[model samples]
Target: MQNFLDDNFLLHNDIAEDLFHNYAKSQPIIDYHNHLSPQEVAENKKFENLTQAWLYGDHYKWRAMRANGIDEHYITGQASDKEKFLKWAETVPYTVRNPLYHWTHLELQRYFGITELLSPKTAENIYEQASAQLQAETHSTRDLLQQMNVKVICTTDDPIDSLIHHQTFAQEQSSFQMFPAFRPDKAMQTEQPQVFNTYIDKLAEVSNREISDFQTYLDALKARHDFFATQGCCVSDHGLSHLYADDYTEDEVAQIFQKIRKQELITTEECNKFKSAMLVYFAEWDHEKGWVQQYHVGAFRNTNSRKFNELGADTGWDSIGDFKQGEALVRFLDRLDKENKLAKTILYNLNAVDNDLFAAMTGNFNDGSVVGKIQFGSAWWFHDQLDGMTKQINALSNIGLISRFIGMLTDSRSFLSFPRHEYFRRLLCNIFAEDIQKGLIPNDIPWIGSMIADICYHNAKNYFPFNDSAV
Candidate 1:
């Protein structure tokens, strides 16, 4: 049998190997969307141990560990770091068919140069070696990023954020730039009146204005948007259950906002109207500033109230949502396109069933201003694995121009996660190689390899307005 994780780990043929090695592997990553801490980059913090680096804050690992019947103490509970790691080691082999299996070994191999499969017997040595390396200055957060050839990172941030860490990186002229992407999810969360009001208070403090009315609220958010623009932010991201395009008059939205400010409970219809208005307003600002807007839709979050109450959100309690998407999504885009107010947009659906729908939906509004004006985004969240990526790539290739597709993002909270980009590249190159080998396409390696390189790097470099040269 073939050895585990050799140089040709995901490559199945000669052409696939060559394409990945020559074209895809060495391309600098532009992770245009992620949740990495900018503060960690600025401070260049060293991970204290393997667990701190690998386990802590990684809900992906937590989910897998739980699936393997590992206990809470070994995950996010009171166990020591080494104990938690040992538990993870015992769970790794059991994850054989899961994406976690590949991701685990890839991260270990890429970051620590450990080719041996992780198991209970090997965990101690591996942990010692990696933890020792992590303690070194050369393996600090910033150094880790540099070693991985990460060119630019756009961290998801609330509009009210000061972006001080990003400013710090800019002032120092660091090798890699960390720009913030505007995520105004809290701004549109009118259902949680008290929480939203608290957020507004913070926004008011940052903007030096009171938000007593809907117009004032919009003005406050616009001020933050302009502030973000000044900091080289060219992207806006929304994490939504689904697209919202409920019809409402300006007066209705105004009244809704007023009622919310008073902490009154709004009906589902009213909530949708308010959210819809905010979405359009955000899109308008994006268009006005020539920025790209990305929507991550259909996440049914906080499913386990018991777990959510104990651990909070993004702690592995979320799952794919089956919300009705087409009507509202189409209406939203059409509303913007008809008015010539739609920005360069990317749509990501957590539910893979919507892959074809999103692909076709994007086609309806590519109004010739840009080559790929509207894009079906890469597979995200629950769909970032091999099967999901293949489906997304094929769907885009079938119905849209995959040539102009801006590719993968980490969307991870770990410094060690950049290897995921390499994972995607290998999978991508393998697909093209197979297509060429099967006589489905020309036996032209060079032409196909160029396309691979574009998907891996050039497409994103050309698509985003972020200054890569500055980094």
Candidate 2:
């Protein structure tokens, strides 16, 4: 009925249209969490073609292409850039009703100003045009970020990282702030002793210490956390199937770590105890330093072992996990809250089923120390789509204060994914507008407009520790 992706593409009414265009659209983006390469941004890397810019490292497209029966070569293998673009274009029309369809065209329209739909018929011409634009100096990595009005980007970095690139960005004082978020999944991975030992050795080397025991290991991690803090990092992230809060004393955890150091197989209970202890230690440090701690849970990753073995992790073989999250998650937070060590926390759940539960969980410890201190983070990963985002916003509004919610993040490796913030803003405004029209809420534009602006940009600006220069 309506023309595709016009100015009012997703806005359903006059109220939605005004809210989006007048308030939400012009807001600067604060991408609080993402997997973007610091080296790429620091070097201002230019892509060779549209394929490199769009296809490479985007597992979302890879998943769609595979569903459309595209082969490995065209998706992630030795195919030429043009070949991959052609394959993706061929698969675009089949993506109708999928969020990728909207994302694909939205990117094309926003970045290249291409209104023509992508298909095999127009693949070559579109690829050549977009690729040519990418080759220009104006389209370099940092330039692309500037074009999207990205104020700050928090890149995921491991505990063992030297953060040399982040240091470089800080020294240069680039237009947009690029800071690292400490992600220490390896530090708590006691189940994989051999691999974890390798990571511990790397941490020890970087920290200039010998980690022969649990306390030393914690010290090494603490040293790196302090280093990250010096570099203006105020966020720590964790990705796990679920949180761990097993009961264990210091002696038990120390013995567990010693067993791991000896490369001995520990029981599942031992693994939980060690992980729980590490989580508490990390939370204490985060609280002490006045940092935000984020937990991204419920991902059943690398399900296709054959594909994972051949191609490696985060190559689109993962799915939402249905793990029992409530008890452990609550216990973990309770432990930190009991000691007054709970830092400003954000919890992101991949499974939609846990939406209401997470919404309720955040309300448990909002001790008025800060507004929305413990937040249910923006709809994440696979749930970053239209319906998923709507559900998350609705649940948060129902059980928590949506006004204080720190809003969207890319959580992506791709530079072009900033438009996802726009998508989220549109959905957010539409929900409020629809409710206002139905007389469920007040029709006060200035007040609601301010709320939209807050969710779009201002909330995160206030929530994060980045200074006035960064915003």
Candidate 3:
């Protein structure tokens, strides 16, 4: 058998090896969606240790450690950073079949040039070595991104954000570009009246507007959307359990907003109507500004109430949800398509059961206004692994045009996560090579390699409105 993680780790054939090494390996990354801290990038922050860089705020490892019977103290509590990382290293050997196993080693190799597999015996030595490198000037946050050849990153931001860090980064003239993606989920979240009203108050303060009715609220949010555009934002993102398409009149939505402002809990139907209206408004605004809008749906977030109360959201309590997505999604898109206000849209589903549903949904609204105008987004959240990625690619290739597809995003908070793009490109080239070996496709290396290159970098360069001058 071949050595583990050698030069051809994921590459399965001669064609696959050639395709990846030559065409896909060196492409610049376009991380279209991620949760990386703009402040860290702006300040060129350097991590004090490997744990701070790797384990801190990374719920992927936290979940794995918890699965390995690691305590909350060792995972996310007051345990020292080195202790936490030691727990993670102890758990690494047990993660043999998990994607975390591959990712952990991939990160260690890519970032620190460590070829030794991590374990309890070697954790201390590996940690000290990697931590020393992290302290170097060449290993700052910005430098890490440049080391991975990241060209553009779009961070998720709320409507009330100051974006001062983005402004600071813009003035620095770095090699990579960072842009903000407007994520206005809180602006329309009317679930808890107190929380909703509090968010509205913050929005009013940020937009410097008086909010009294639905019209004024929309105006304030619109102003922030305009400000985001001025700050070089060309994308919007929303997270939801599913699409909302409840029919309601403007007056009805206005009444619902008034009830929300008064801190009165609205009925479920009223909440849906208000959210549907807000979604339409956001999509229209995105279209008007020539922005790409993304929807990441079907996550049952914070399922464990006790842990959520202790740790809050996005700490790995979320799971894939089996929500009905077909009819309502069609209604939502058809509503915009009929009005001619549909912007370029990307749809990501957490449930793999909806793979074909999402892939087929793109064909319904791809009105030819743009190439792959309605895209089935990359496999997301729990589905970003090998089986998940392959199934998604196969579904899209069968039902839609994978040629026009924009490729992977880290969707990660760690700087070491850029190797996920490398992972995806290698897997993708292998798939094409396997098909060629089976005589399913012609053996046209240059032509197929060009397609691989486009999927790796060129497609995103052409799709996103980051820099018109980018090659």
Top-lDDT candidate index: 3
For residue 96, model 3's alpha carbon misses the true position, in angstroms, by: 1.1
The CA lDDT at 199 in model 3 is 92
- lDDT preference between candidates 1 and 2, better one: 2
Off by over 4 Å in 1: none
| Predictions in order: lDDT | 0.91, 0.92, 0.94
Which residue pairs of candidate 2 clash?
none
- Least lDDT summed over 10 consecutive residues: which range in candidate 3? 462-471
Per-residue lDDT of model 1, residues 1-471, tens digit only: 556778887898999999999989999899999999989988889999999988888988899999999989889999999999999999999989788899999988888888889999999999999999999877899988988899899999999989998888778866788889999999999878899889989999999998889999999999999999999999999999999999989999999988988899999999999999999999999999999999999999999999999989889999999999999998999999999999999999899998999999999999888878898999998888999999999999999998889999999999989988998998998898898889998988788889888988888888888774743
Residues 375-413, model 2: lDDT tens digits: 999999889999999999999999999999999999999
Q: Clashing residue pairs in candidate 1, if any?
A: none
lDDT of 3 by residue, 354-402 (tens): 9999999999999877998999999998989899999999999999998
TM-score of each: 0.98, 0.99, 0.99
What is the alpha-carbon lDDT for the whole of candidate 1? 0.91
